[model samples]
Target: MIQSTDEGLMRLALREAAKGLGRTSPNPAVGAVLAKNGIILATGYHQKAGQPHAEIEVLKALSDYPSAKGSSLYVTLEPCSTYGRTPPCTLAIRDAGISRVIVGSIDPNPKHQGKGLAELRRDGIQVTTGVLDKECTRLNAGFNKWIISGRPWVIAKAAQSLDGRLTRPIGESSRLSNSHSIRMVHRLRATVDAILIGAETVRKDDPELTVRYGPTDHQPLRVVVTKTGMLPIDARVFVGEQDTIIYKDRSWSDVLDDLGRRSVTRLLVEGGGQILGQLFDNYLIDELWFFLTPRLVGGDKPTIGGVGVQELAGAPRLVDVRYLRLKDDLLIKGDLQWPKNPSRAF
Candidate 1:
């Protein structure tokens, strides 16, 4: 049995956890709330990797150490029992004199999975698990994927007309998304570890691909995958101050493998049809974000190119579909139904 109060507190914890999404790589964003007799005492969230976790943040935020005694703690993710970059959170929770713990999701890492709860129970503290489990799990999908598969979570995004045309037949660069959508794209870029594009996009668009709409501490690594080693010498990508990497004459798998090794937990792929085609062909895409405008551009240029599905059964489908209106444009985002390649899951 679960209480509405518990659900509400867990939801707040989840909201707090999301604040650290872009900043916490190689670590899941977690939030915590301390409450006594249905009254909230303190709230905190994890800020970055190798820093104090959510449990520590909440405990330290308390005005008095004795205030947390016999209070219930609600957390989006389980407390860690082992030390890595910081001290074990379970020990801290016990030391704080917390009487009960309500958790949203268990630790995804095998080494710490369920161990935290076991240690707390051994100390005679009451523990409740799986409060808003689905939401908690989805919040850290990128971290979970990176932890389990040793690869980044791939997000394929594009802006096309209603008729599915990326640009004019001449392949000239044009703005299909509105000002609001462009801002949204910039915000999305801030949350990812890297931005990837095909060679053709570099030659045609010559995009700088920096986060300009809002404030970001660091620019994501710019990546370009090219079959041939030829590219414009003065492309903006090359001239930009941000770190850039060119994968000339390399397979998509090789590029992803190297990026994974570099600890890129979330990768955004902005495309020029051919690059998107390669991703789709390789079944490398985990999520899709398409901005569809009201106007239709009837042309031979499709949003995605490459040998597409020959039969209806072979076509890919999206799950957990979401549609949002960004000004006049429609943003369609969803996860792919099929599992990504286990070898190169980025």
Candidate 2:
């Protein structure tokens, strides 16, 4: 049973977990709170990959471990029971003399599922599960999806005019999003593990595709997919110091499989239409974010190219959709109900 105070503490833990979102790749952002008598002693969050997890950070923050012998620890996710880069957190919790362990969600990884809680119970520590479960689960939705599906969560993004045009009448590139929305796109780029674009976009937009609107210690990998290896050698994407990958004449599924093998948990596809169309045609995209500007650039170059579904029922539907006002543009975001692999439940 969880008290109201426990929910509040778990919410705080979730907030702490969010601080690591962009930096923690191949690992879920987890937060932990140590409390005694309903009062928080210390709070911590996972900072990056191959670093101390949330539970270890909370245990290390304690100035006097003996004084907080009966402290209760609240974590957004299950404490890891296996040794990887660091020792098992379950052992640390038991040695720390914590009396109760409340977890928001179980580890989605099949190997770690419920093992941490089971370990804690074996050591005589009181365990409570599923405190603020939905938020905790949603916080690491990309991680969970990757863990279960073995592929990165794909988010397709584009900036388009109200009339659904992606460029001018002559097929020249044009900026449709406002300055604020552009910064938002950059922020989105910073959060994902990689940014994917088509070669046509590279030739026309010539975007650097690096995070420029804000400060970031790491930049997402820039990936360009093309049938013909015809991009200019002097293109900014190739010239920049940041890492970039060129996939020539490869299947989209194969590209995704390779990305998954590289442990990319989140992938953002910013495109010039044909690529986005192929992804949509294959049901590879999981989420969508489109910035719609106030202006209408009437032309044959729409945001999406290719022969779309002939039947209305064949079209994919967006669920849990949201519209946000970004300066002069509207940011429409949602998840696609269709999955790349229909058998996989991501």
Candidate 3:
């Protein structure tokens, strides 16, 4: 498909919208740009929930919206039509006399949905949908998942040695990936609502699980899954952050409900073998991000405590595998296609 120059600009606007990842809970991150005759005028993005929408921010930035009556507006998501905390974005577009609007994707909120686009048509405005749609949809995947499934989209992340081992010998907490990859993991932590690890992992690694990389507006909630509820009070995970949760044994459905109640739309699961086995056994994992390192630990060690499939044919398969080389480590990210179930958490 051929993309126009404006589409490229809209794509950039969408990227600008993603800056508010962990901060924008209960609201999708949106980016907008106002342009006239292929020249950009103003640009803005939704920073957090209850704040002004991207369109409002852009219009506020411009001194005179009436002067740019023939200008085009590019937004990552559909402008809202409802009276949220602020006024409807549809009304603002009409008042500004914007001749054209290019939307990256339709908003998933049932209250508005396509109503914003419909309002634009009523006002004799030219509107376009699906401009760089795939990328835009991906940018707000967490929001969509929460709206549709009522649960956070879980990503099970792990680093495996060349021989399929997850770690080094016992009592030795050596680093698996390089320093660059460690920073990348911190970046991933910044985007999610919470990070999960087994009690064993916390006791073994004593990881702080805080953002030590680039600038991030919000830090994810640190979570520990425990069976005995004997987590150390002085553990590194508990030293600084008070926003930590220690979850006990519960049904997979209830786990999903608990996360939903916490407004954790995006969850990253960093686990040891036993914890990974439990999630996989219940078919609760939504995505997988496994890193393959160059060093090989040629021993009896295994990557994860075998996710009890019972049969070889029933072993989980992660398709659409992609490999990105970070230094010598190969990061393989893929989506797991589990079968349909009563609860969409799987």
RMSD of every candidate to native, in Å, equals 2.2, 2.2, 2.4
Q: Is candidate 1 or candidate 3 better by lDDT?
A: 1
Q: Name every residue pair that clashes in candidate 2.
A: none
Backbone atom clashes (below 3 Å) for every candidate: 0, 0, 0
Candidate 1 residue lDDT tens string, 1-346:
5777999999999999988876788788899999999999999999989999999999989988899999999999999999899999999999999999999998879989999999999999899999999999988888888888778889999999999878754565558889888998998898788999988888878899889888777578999887777888889988767889999888776887788888888899999888888788778888899999988878677888878766667667899899999889999999887643354343
Candidates ranked by TM-score, best first?
A: 1, 2, 3
TM-score of each: 0.93, 0.93, 0.91
Residues 1-346, candidate 2: write the lDDT tens digits. 7877889999999999988876788999899999998888999999999999999898778887785589999999999999899999998898889999999998899879999898899999999999999889977878998898778899999999899877755565557788989999988888788999999888888889899887666688899998999998888898667789999999877898888888888899998888888887776778899999999778677777777766777677898899999877999999887623463345
Local distance difference test values of all predictions, in order:
0.87, 0.87, 0.83
lDDT of 3 by residue, 30-87 (tens): 9999988788888888888899999988888887767658889999999998897999
| Model 3, backbone clash pairs (residues 3+ apart or across chains), number | 0
Better of 2 and 3 by lDDT: 2
Better of 1 and 3 by TM-score: 1
| Model 1 TM-score relative to the real fold | 0.93
- Deviating ranges (above 4 Å) for candidate 1: 169-174, 339-346
Predicted structure 2: lDDT:
0.87
Lowest summed-lDDT stretch of 10 residues in model 1? 337-346
In model 3, where do residues sit more than 4 Å from their true spots?
A: 1-3, 63-67, 298-301, 308-321, 339-346
